[model samples]
Target: MERKRHHEEASSESDDENYVPYVPLKERRKNEILKVTKKLGRAGRLLQEEEKKESTDDGGMQDEEEEIQVGPNANMSLLDQHSELIKKAEAKKESAREKLLKEEERILESVAENKALMGVAELAKGIQYQDPIKTGWTPPRAILAMPKERHQRMRKKMEILVEGEDIPPLCITFKEMKFPHIILKALKKRGIEKPTPIQMQGIPVVLMGRDMIGIAFTGSGKTLVFALPIIMFCLEQEKRLPFVKNEGPYGLIVCPSRELAKQTTEIINFFSRHLVEDGYPALKCLMCIGGMAIKEQLDMIKQGVHIIVATPGRLMDMLEKKMVNLDICRYLCLDEADRMIDMGFEEDVRTIFSYFKGQRQTLLFSATMPKKIQNFARSALVKPVTVNVGRAGAASLNVTQEVEFVKNEARMVYLLECLQKTPPPVLIFAEKKQDVDAIHEYLLLKGVEAAATHGSKDQEERSWAVDQFRKGAKDVLVATDVASKGLDFPDIQHVINYDMPEDIENYVHRIGRTGRSANRGVATTFISKACDESTLLDLKYLLIEAKQKVPPFLAQLEAESEKYLEIGGEVGCSYCGGLGHRITDCPRLEAVQNKAAQNIGRKDYLASNAADW
Candidate 1:
């Protein structure tokens, strides 16, 4: 009020009809002289007081009043000081009736734009995150008061670690997490009896409304960690304040792969059905991914939507077309976040971030978080709690890893014997689409029910293959690395890598397909001369870390890696998350950096643009 009153008073003089600029330079100079005289008078008095005090307190001082006020360009030794002072005196004074905060200050407060004019530009306006909610609903005192040592012991037992400031405690069970009755019932219906390591800690942190980075081995039920909470969140919001037409999607789940997006949407649909059954408001969740008709998705949003699970490309396209708006969207979860970056979706992800209307609760779930992804997380999410189950990029301990030296020609024959060792429902991962098709054909000729998925397969075919495998209709699913990231298949007895993956991270994800949901499984990897020594060395160290037996061929590499291993300790290669090699020797890191450079290089058409006449 005081500032406003002063501003109004000062502006009143200028608001008068007689207000005008000074006609002569002499008139402005007179006013500036008055102001400068007052300023210098005050400075001279203060300096005199200090000089007097010093002389009285100590010995007599000959020199006094040393400080002097001068114009910015008034250098003591320069001859132009007199002219600079004259120029300064003729300058215009700033307005006294200024805005409280400049444009830059408003942005710092998250007020990127001024309030819109009502009835003019207000239609479909977004909720500004001027004062975003930093913390979620308060948890029970017991959860908040858990002892640090008890938290540590629980995490150690589960082989999980939660690191951040003001981290919420983990829940022992689904009920302990204080989920709604609908959620509890849905969990029971899905047979999710207890929380996995990632779920235990991740659910609590996200439910508390904090941003999170969840890193667990693949097949550790990372889907439910975000799925259940998002269901509860959407349900609560609808019951409290329902969404109207064209006005929602309070929750979002982003997947790198379209198949994973479909899977997550299915889970949400199931829970949404449960919510409706319990007489809750209908929570609309949309799978806003590509390979589907955009018109149908637009139709769904016209009614209302509470959640969306989408891939980067499709989501970005929708945002660009103005078909979808993130005006009220919150609670974003990035599943297989590291894979998203690995697949070159970082820019799309950032572009998607620009559409967000307000600050939101973001969750990142991945099997591996290399340094590149870690840096992305730091920029995208708020202060986030990182809940890691087992080591990042570590192969699951539940899978018994077996590496064999099979010549290129002998792998096909050995694969038959390897399959015979395990029962039905085995997963085989090949690096190439052609290899996947060939393996599927060979398995079918042997009277084995099998399916294949790859980039060449359309969305429907890919989904059908996964469903057939999940339902036990097919005993085997041969796929490229597409299936290795975030697809959930239950009760697989064995996994075989038809050939070694190019990188160690892909190797971990391949075997991770089987040993999921606390089930013991086997992973057999066949390597020939085609496989390089670097990946083999990484595999050897990985097997040793998981306590798997080392083959005779890999024993030599193990001895070689021991010296580097001892130096690395628990801090392995922070760049690519490889165990045997440091960042200096990492192959994937070199490739990604080279690709990044290439992305910024000139296009072919631009090369011949010089003096084309």
Candidate 2:
């Protein structure tokens, strides 16, 4: 049995060696093609079966077959039966194809019907699809959406003028202005029942969607005059386009200084916070200024903001980087317009205006209207309602002005004496940055808590000084003209001009800082021979116009004295030629006196020096 098994295994091994294991590539490819063809045929049969089932279920078609009994004399062959089955499968496939084509046509018809319904709905809602490429798209009824009769009423009440046309009177109270209940509540919470003169007139004009140039005194509530209207407009826009996240803000407010920008943003926050509490969408306000980090600002912008309060220089930087775009901006406000022009930001302002090409409501609030500012207004603003609350280029009547005549060498001594008598929280202004620093140092040395702010100081240092002064940590703040405009510090008792400003308009602004928000304050200016004669007459006029006491010396200066007196010419001590020190205080004079005293008994040295001289 073992030999037989061995013989079978040996025969199997010999057979394996004789047989070829690998097939030719051509024959293998042909076999694969045949296998694929059979699979495709089976797939087609399955699809046809599914379609037939669906058709029967729908009661559209039915298939019937009768079974035939095969007797001993049956002549049907297996090959003939297979061919008959194939023909039946082909017929089912054809029926399935026709059904698919019909279903496709039905689907197309349904889609067309849906599109038509949507178009009709849009038309009914009065929603017009504007081409973004052709026209800058702004939401319909985004702002100033009041009815014509109500608008006319509001205009008449506030004496609102549009293109020099007078409308009918409207409501006077905050509630009558049709502000949201929450906004009115916020105003009430702040104990602000009556609007200031500027707000009373400016609000209605802004609400009517008219461009405006508001000339109001400092602390006349001008900030709120523009801020409240802007907040309302932004809220309206937010409601209209809930998902819009523009690259830039919808409302852009440009101020001359960072502090003013920050102040405006705070006001926006104060109003917007109430809106969010009343179930409205939260309005985001960004203060983009030089001292803050640009990256953080960029991040906030990316998250989306409704309003942007920015200074010209920092805003220009962001604009150049393409981080912000004002193409869709609807409202533009230039706060402290005259100050911005005076700071040489005219070109920057123009560049910013060029970026906003669409229809925008512009509001310019300035303390004074200079010729340059007037020209800027003509070019930048539309037919705006000019609201002048008081006389232009005049100081506030709330502040009492006094001029003290002191020698240049005694100015610091006078400042120290003034500080001893006056209350804390004093703002001191100097003409030059060096003088500001020197005064700040001198005050510190004299045991008076003081801080300094100037153009030469870094942004961080300037902000620190302002913050310290605001918090009462520093009683005195010595600053240059940079702080003379649009900075609001509550309860500031006095403003001291340690050195008189060369420009008379600057003197007006310097004193204007103290008497803010109807608070009574005092402005004391120190006059010396070093001051330019040209500004004396203008200064006297300003003081007199504001009902301030003008000194006899200043009132007597001639108007033509400015042309004769060189601005920067020497006008100090004969010996030292230094404005801050007298001939008696000169170091060289002291040294010569000490030498002469030491050589009093040396006759030989005196005779030799005299002969040489």
Per-candidate clashes come to 0, 7
List, residue by residue over 1-613, the lDDT tens digit for candidate 2: 9999999999999999899788965458557756765788977567656855775785632222112435542456778777877999988866764564455335334322122111233334544322211112222342336576775565456444333344213335666566788988998886678776667667767777767788776767788877887788777777888635545488899998876787788889998888888899888888889977898888888887889999999999998888998877888889988778656786787678667646577788877764334544654455556776665555788988989899999998789888765699999999888899889889988999999999777788988898888889999999998888878887798999998886656777788888887789888999988876545555665666677777889877654322322222322222322222223233434555677677875877889899999
Give the worst 10-residue stretch by lDDT in candidate 1: 92-101
Best by lDDT: 1
Per-residue alpha-carbon lDDT of candidate 1 for residues 408-512, written as tens digits (9 for 90 to 100): 888877889999888989999999888889888988898888999998988889889999999999989999988888877768879999999988989988898
- lDDT, candidate 2, residue 246? 49
Where is model 1 more than 4 Å wrong at Cα?
A: 1-136, 558-562, 566-570, 596-613
Candidate 2 yields a Cα-based lDDT of 0.71
TM-score for each model: 0.76, 0.64
Write down the RMSD of candidate 1 (Cα, Å).
22.8
